[model samples]
Every structure is written in structure tokens, then in C-alpha cells.
Target: MDDDRERLTSKPETSDPLPKAEHPWVETLKTIGLSVVLALGVRSFVADSRYIPSGSMLPTLQINDRLIIDKLSYRFSDPVRGDIVVFHPPAQLERELVANGEKKFQEAFIKRVIGMPGDRVEVKGGKVYINGKVLAENYLGEPPRYQWSSTELTPDGIVPPSHYLVLGDNRNNSYDSHYWGFVPQDKVIGKAILRFWPINRAGGITPQPDYNN
Candidate 1:
């Protein structure tokens, strides 16, 4: 039976030889290309990861702390106070960076939302007040010590429509909306869902506030 089976399968003639090497390489290339595309699509639309770069979010997020962001959430619900977020640098901050000749990763910055759209916020006497109430920022390593200067966004400001006032939990150290401006809704990339770095601190991030709207 083995001899008969071997005789039944004939080799290709010289005139009709198959291009064996090319087919394997082409298939491998196509597979690799598809995999890359799929990965990028998932990262852009489904979810992505980021690491804490500064002490702004200290006490909550430490430098080099990695996070998994939920890019899908903001599509359905708006950001709320207390939720940690990742967003592209606002235009004002970007311009300042360029003018100063600084070279930093031009990626998004992460911070905790302090005020939602239309909320009145003021930082004075070393405290952050939102909607006439001081933010109970238990996550801070210390009370906000830096006063928001006139050049900053305080002195009782109203958050613009489709924007949010975000600050680092490390209020005194973070360069956030206080130094720039509100994070436009369009520039928001996602909600910080979990922290998966530094081993012992592996857990969910600060929960999002329950907003009526």
C-alpha cells in the first residue's frame, strides 16, 4: 500500500514547477501584516496602556506605574470628577513646550478630573474648590500647597463646555490643566481603569464618580 501511494503522487515537470520559497515568504509577510494591523486597531479603539511619568498623580499613581486605559468608556459616558484620565496636551501647553525648546514624549498626559464642564473651580489658600465645595482629595500625599497663580486657570473659573478641569493627585507637583487649560473632550483618549505595575500596588484605579447626568 505504501509503494502504491508513492507511485500515485507524481512530481511536477520542469516546465510546471511550483515556486515553493516565494509562497511561504509571501504568506508569512501577509500574516505578519495582518497581525500588526489588528493589534493597532485594538489599541486605538478598544484599550491601551500607559505609564505614569511624573509625581503629579503621586500617592495614587507613582512614576513608572503602568495603567490599562478603557478607551471604550468615554464613547458612551462623559468623564466625571475623580476619574483618572489620559489626554493629549492642550494647545496652550504644547505651544509653551515648543517655545521653550523642550523635548519630551509628545504623548498624552494623565490626571484626575477635578471639575466637569460648567463647574466653577477655584484654587486659593492652598485648597481646590469645585462648585463651591473643597475637593476631598484623600488620595493626595499632602494638601495642595501651590496656589494657582493668575496665569493659571484658577481665580474662580468656569470649565468650558465639552471640557474638564484635570489635576494631578500630586497637586503641588503636577503640570496639568492648572498650567494649561481644560482638556477638550475630543482630545481625551481614555479612562484609567487599572494599575498593573510596582507589584504590590496592582489593583483598580480610583473609581469614577457617580454623576447624575
Candidate 2:
């Protein structure tokens, strides 16, 4: 009887083995959540892609052209003339757009840097002159069809420190700095570096060739 009692009282062998397969749905949801978080983080802090929605950069960037913007490089260096960039519109321009029935105002403007801070800029007689030198801009899909009659906008004034002047390739009709004002250096988001969509034009986006040389 004592032997029987000892055998019966012996602690049952512990069988706490973890399940071989985790709850399948729980793992799937976790994986999806992680993927989404990683994608958003990369987009916000690394690089971002945007689609060209207008002809402002025609012949170079077409409508629906997919571009990969280099958000990282600008952190190490300031924008240079000829670098294509995307930036937020100035506050006054935003207000104007909203008041003009564009309640859901478009996000940002893309243009090429034509002048940097402290540089003199002038546009007259169908040519853009920088610091008294006529800039040779051959990238314009079409010639600048409008002449600036305003003295304040003439290449006469020096670009403000920490500001840049930009213009679209489609100079004749683009709603850009010429229509508004300078893009503050800090407002610049990133330089456009590549055209990844529309297959035919997929390649490295070129900065305007240096004209100073």
C-alpha cells in the first residue's frame, strides 16, 4: 500500500512544451503591422517618391513621371544652381490658392535652381541673366514667352541670403517663383535624382550642365 501511494503521489511529469506553431493570424497581423511601420519610416526619413502631375518640368519630367527624390543628400549640402528640387510654396501663395477655390491646395512646387543667395538675377528680352552674365539655358522645352515688366523681379536685385530663385522648364506658364517669389532654402524638401516611371524616360535625372566653365 505504501509503494502504491508513493507511485500515485509522484508529481506528474511537467508537459509545458510550447505550441509548435504560433497563432497564425496573430503572426500575420504582426508582420503586416511591422511592414507598414517600416515603409512609412523609410519614406519620411530616407527617400520619397512623387509623381509629376503637370508640365512644369516638361521634356525633362513628364506628366505621371515617377521620381525618386534624394532626401538624404540635401542634409549634408545646400542646394546648388541647376539642381532640380521640390519645395513647399510660400505662405502667401498658399493663401492665394486657397482663396481662389483650391481648398485642397496642391502640395509643393518643383523647379530648377537658377540663382543662389547673394547672386544677382535678371530676366529680360527673352533671356535669363545671372550676375550680369547671360545664362545659357537650353533645357527649356520652350522659350520664355513672357517678359518681366516689374523692377522688383528684374535680375537687378540680389537674391536674399538663405533664399533661392527657381524656374520651371515650362517657363511660359508654370506657376513658380517667377509668379510668386523665392523658395526659402529651408523650405526645400529634396533634390530630384531619378525618373523611375514611364519606362522610356527611366534614367538618372541630370542637373543642368555647368555653364560657368
Candidate 3:
């Protein structure tokens, strides 16, 4: 009778270790599920992870400054004047032009929109004149006077009926519309919505107030 009771108590101890071996697979599945969730989150929001690559938008956006470009907002409406945009260079035009018909690779540029379709654009006394009126820009770090050529656009050069003209805030140092031309509506990727990374500079990028509309 004493031996029979001891045998029954030892049976439970052997069974308990079997379930511990099964837990590894359950933990692996949990880790995989979390990874999928993170990937989906990045795709949905404007990723708060981009860096400025050039000095074209210097006074406002600096090189190496990480930014958050909004990919959703522009889906509801077209880009407006004074909006800073990122886009691929217009096809066929290059950083350098050929003497006859040569092609060169011009990296994409970033700049602010000063004119749009159906609007006349001009620059005088370092001031931008749109539709026979002067535009007030309080964001420029310096007046644009001696750096750019006096540009005039005819009805045909006026943004191709669906395009936009853009320029850098640092006019003298930027190579923008004064060189290549207008940005095609389809080439526009997204708007620069905010500055991130540098905790001190993290904030929303307010859209330039619209006086033309």
C-alpha cells in the first residue's frame, strides 16, 4: 500500500516538463505578428523619416535635416502657390544642356512655388511679381537681386496648363525653374509637411498664406 501511493505521485512530475517544450513555437509566432504590425504602420502615415539632400531650400530646409513629407494631403487637392514640394526632374531636361542635342542627368530639386498655371510670373528688384502684382515674402533670408536672370513666361510657358513653377528660398544659390522649367503635375511626389529628427526643430510646416486665391 505504501509503494502504490508513491508511484502515483511521481507520474505528475514527468508530465509537467512536456508542456514547457511546446512554448517556443508560441513565442516565435508572437514576435512575427508584431513585425507585421510595424510595417503596416509605416505605410499608412506620412513617414516621419526623410532627410534634406540639397541646399536649394537652404534658408528653410537644410541638408541632413530629417523631415516628414505628407503623402496624403495632396491626394485631396492640387498643390498651391507657396507650398514647398518634392518631385522628380521633368523628363528630357538635365542638369546641363547639350550644345546640339545632348542629355545630362540633373538630380531632382526642391523649391517653393511662386507661380502656377494661368499666372504670369516675373522677378524684379529681387522681388517676385505675380500677375502684375508684387508678392510679399517674409521668409527669404536675403533679397533676390543680382543672382537670377529677369524671367518672363508667355502663355505657352505658363506651366503647361497643369504644371507649376517653383524656386528655392535661397534664390542666388538655387538652380530651379530658372534652369529646367516647370514641374509636371504627375511628377510631384508629396509636400514637405514637417521637420523631424532634430527635437528642437520638430514642428508643423504651416502652408504659406494664399493671397492669390
Give lDDT: candidate 3, residue 68. Answer: 74
* Clash counts for the predictions, in order: 0, 2, 1
lDDT of 3 by residue, 62-135 (tens): 77877777766777889898888877777534534453354644444567987888776777788777776778
| Candidate no. 1 TM-score | 0.78
What Cα-based lDDT does every candidate model obtain?
0.81, 0.81, 0.71
Tens digits of per-residue lDDT, candidate 1, 1-213, equal: 988887789664557657666687888999999999999999989999888877778888888999999999999999888989899987888887888897785678888998888788777777777666666666778887766632356454678889888888887787888777888999999999988887799999885543222
Total colliding residue pairs, candidate 3: 1
lDDT winner between candidates 2 and 3: 2
Question: Which ten residues in a row are the worst by lDDT in model 1?
Answer: 147-156
Tens digits of per-residue lDDT, candidate 2, 92-125, equal: 6787798789988778778899888887776787
Off by over 4 Å in 1: 1-30, 103-105, 149-156, 208-213
Q: What is the lDDT of candidate 2?
A: 0.81
Which regions in candidate 3 have their CA more than 4 angstroms from the true location? 1-48, 95-108, 146-157, 207-213
